[model samples]
Target: METNRNSNIIKLKQNLKYRNILIDAFPLLGLIIIILFFTIITSGNLLTLNNLKIILNQMFLYLIGGLGSVYLYAQGGIDVSMASNIGFSAILGVRIMYQHVGIGIIATLLIGSSIGLLMGIIYAYAGIPVFIQGLAMDFLLKGTLYPLSGFKASIPVPDRLLKFDNKYFAWIFLLIIFIFIFFTYNFSRFGKECRSIGAGEIASIQSGIKVKKNKVLAFFISGLTCGIVAVYTLIRTGSASQSTGLGFNFNVMLSLVLGGCVLGGGNGVKVRNAVIGAVTFVVLQNGLVLCGASARAQDIVKGILFVLMIVFTSKMYERKV
Candidate 1:
């Protein structure tokens, strides 16, 4: 009886491991399926070189933001203020640019890092929930943004820097960022520490992980990324508006989720996940438009897909008894 019980337990563990492997592959599988489906439905227009360029352009910022966010999500923290942070950072960068041509870029990055560091301090040391801190920050920035811009519909980019808008520049910049993040995330101590924290904070603390420091670092990285993307957004649109970073928080979250990165973190985080998800998301949106899906219909489809993916991911990563 004892031997039989042990054998059955081993088999159960194997089955669970196999199931997890399949779940892990789902995002990539889904990406392929979605692309093929859209390609067929759009009658091959989706695969054209020009359309592919459009998809790459659309996904560039999302991929950058998503990469930065992997650190936060790995530690099981969420920041709803990132979108507002990006918007406010861009505004500050623009103001500085107006005073001195090149200094504005550095100023914007610094402001973003500062805000992220502040939030991380509050969340890690002050005992505030990261989410609440994010909400408060968002509101504060949005309130100040209106008065600072004098309620302008948008702030136009400096004509001299307009050349940055070219896709070639964008791709090179994105590639550099991606390479840096990929190395840091896969090989650095920071990645391991974050995964440990996400797996369980109490356990991480007991293991001498310096949870507070790592948490702050994660937030700072996230902020830095937001700031960089703010520059990208400003260049891409050649302007910054009240709506400049609107919906970014949602879009990044969605991209991460779609890429199979769990909200609770720890188990299945990868830099490639963000890239895959970002590309998949852009393709999905562009395909829908080509197929003439109305805005309402698109939202419905997206909502349903989001729910299904969440359910699938959650189940895949659940702890077994």
Candidate 2:
């Protein structure tokens, strides 16, 4: 019966392989399920063209911020200062453009990203820890927002600023931006080096990966994404507030984790995963709001779902038997 037992083992392994493929694809499946449920729950309310625009708008905003975050992921680190970065930069960029020569939108992005590049340099080369680096950036940026605004919450943002957030503009802009970055990162030597660094820094360095440069570039892009995302945020709300980026740290981190990037780093590092994860959270929140759930209840549910995602994505539970 030894030969029969061997045949059975082979079959079992094949079955298990298919099972994993499904499990791995579950997040995308879950996204579809949520959309269907959303269609049924809100019926006409959420099924309208305007509603769809709104969803796209939110997605546009979050994904831009999360894009920088994906860079951090690809580089084996994290940037928790997203909300603060966006808010402060929005306030700062607007004021600078309005008061002086109007560096315009593109220039504003450069400034925000420069700040991020500086932060990354400090972290990667100065030997500062990533966690501390993130926390410090968040605080420093947050503190800068109020003073930069001259303690004003209602900065008169130029109407010209609205162009970036316009639906068509965001659609075209985000599409080109992400696709370009995605391919550039996945296909280039720099991209390869970033993932290598994430996989194992010491090993990557030994292999001549230029770890610090890649990390700095990644952080700079992330900062630029923050600025890009902020453009949308300003459009949606029409004004930047002290609380504009109040809870971004938690939201961005949640999106990253849900996307299947491990806590410490090192994975296949896909930006598509980040997009999918952000969509999951957005759908969850939208569903809760439609169901008339309280904010507190929604928060609790989100926490529970995140935990579930962690469990599902965990490798610790692999069964050998």
Candidate 3:
């Protein structure tokens, strides 16, 4: 009986190992399928040089936001207010640019970081649920953004500020941000702690990790990245408007999920999820547009995909148990 039980246990472990391997491969496979599907539908127009650049341009904000969000997601938390936050920051940056370009940039970063820190504080110390707090903040920021942005008017950046909008500059900036996030997330104690908290917050607390502090820091990083994204948006678009970050929050979430990042958070989360998800999301959006899908139709498709991802993620976790 002992020998038989041991054999069964070994077999179970092997089965689980194989299951996980297959599960981990899903995102890459999905990406490939999406690419092929869109390429075919668009008659190969989807991957042309000009189109590729457009996809890359569309990817920057999502990628930046997704990278910053890894920390929050790793801790099983999310800030749905990020879109409003970015918009507000960009508005401030644009307004300030009228005074001084350098200071405007500084203001944007500070505003973004400050809002993030504030959100962190409320989340950590106020004992509020992250989702609730995020929604409240989102509403508050939207309220502020509309009035400040003149309710549908666009605030154009100074001509001098537009000089920073070169494609090469953007690519170089993305590389720098990617390098920083990669190392900080993989090599630092903070990242490990965030994952630990996500895996089991009570257990993490018992293990002597400062859960509250980590939460605040994670949010701060997220905010800082939002600020960076705002700068990028401002430079590229040369303006801030009421719709500056429209649909951005959901887009970022979609990108991360598409890349296989489980919002439920766990030790299994990988940084590559952000990169892959962002690229896939942009390509998907670009392709849909090229196919002449209406905005409403695109949104409906995204909604369906989001629901499917949630179901699939839940099943994967259940199987692991």
lDDT, each prediction: 0.86, 0.72, 0.87
For all the candidates, what are their Cα RMSDs to the real structure? 2.3, 3.1, 2.4
Best-to-worst order by lDDT is 3, 1, 2
lDDT winner between candidates 2 and 3: 3
Q: Total clashes, candidate 3?
A: 0
Q: After superposition, how far is residue 169 of candidate 2 from its true place, in Å?
A: 1.4
lDDT of 2 by residue, 7-65 (tens): 99999999888776776666677677777877787775665787666666666666666
Query: Mind giving the per-residue lDDT tens digits that candidate 1 earns over 1-321?
Result: 999999999999999888767777888898999899999999999999999988988998889989999989989988899999998999888888788757988888988888999889889999888888899999999888876666898889788667666787778878898899888888899888898899999999998899999999999998998889888887778887778799898899999888888889885677877988898888889988989999999999889888888887777767422
Assess every candidate by TM-score.
Answer: 0.93, 0.87, 0.91
User: Which of the two candidates, 1 or 3, achieves a greater lDDT against the reference?
Assistant: 3
lDDT accuracy of residue 34 in candidate 1: 89
Give candidate 3 regions above 4 Å deviation.
1-15, 150-152, 293-300
lDDT of 3 at 55: 90
State the weakest 10-residue window (summed lDDT) of model 2: 312-321
Off-target runs (Cα >4 Å) in candidate 2 are: 1-20, 43-46, 99-102, 163-165, 316-321
Candidates ranked by TM-score:
1, 3, 2
What is the lDDT, from 0 to 100, of the residue 260 in candidate 1? 82
